[model samples]
Target: MYESVLVATDGSDSADRAVDAALDLASVFDATLYAVSVVDTRRYGDSALSGTEDIVSDLETQANELLDAVEKRADGGVMTELRHGKPHAEISDYATAIDADLLVLGNRGRESGEVIGSTAERIVRFVDRPVLTI
Candidate 1:
């Protein structure tokens, strides 16, 4: 019954699986697919003026390329997005902004009741939409 599905990918194998799952769900529901890749801006120091632009540009290019590849593999009704920010915050905001029916993501080896990584756990906590972790 999903109308719009958002899948966040990091070009990892787990994320690839999540993409496949989202694609299958989209196909079944006749839903539109939105693929997002977030470039973590925290990796760069705020005061580092030298080479920061080039580094950020390269990261953006890489993120775009990854999203493009995923979109190519998806069916016709797919859109790609590349964002720069904390991964969880950006993804959650995007889902809300786009009124997504569901947000899909891949678990990066986190166990139940244990501390999940900040990104994945925060996403689960912050996003109002249902999250399907593959």
Candidate 2:
């Protein structure tokens, strides 16, 4: 049985499905639920100093809103976290930080469709956790 479940979302519909799945599992196991949204810092594509702060600010705001929605959808206690970094790295690190019993994510994110996203791929490969991709 899972004691702690972490779900990473990019505010996408696919991720919403993952959230639903994570919430269901957590409820069944009476586990703690954690929702994390990471703002990819790789934006701007070039000059890091050019409006980076504004971009990150906007991204974080959006991410927090998404996390809020995820928490709202859960039936049990939920802890939400917002991070800025590589999506997969942040998600994996959070899972380890919380000693999560399970890591749940969607096969694709907001940026990727018709193919598995790179974040899901890396987290599945690098994280030492039981990942359940929906």
Among all candidates shown, the one with the greatest lDDT? 2
Candidate 2 lDDT for residue 58? 88
Model 2 lDDT per residue over 1-134, tens place: 89999999998878999999999999899899999999887755547735567877888899988998987787437999999878888898899999999999999988786678888899999999799988
Quote model 1's TM-score. Answer: 0.88
For candidate 1, write residues 12-107 as lDDT tens digits: 666788899999989899998999999887767656635568888888888988888887888456888888878888999889888999988877
After superposition of all CA atoms, the RMSD between model 1 and the true structure is 3.1
lDDT of 2 at 64: 89
Question: Each candidate: RMSD to true structure?
Answer: 3.1, 1.6
- Total residue pair clashes for candidate 2: 0
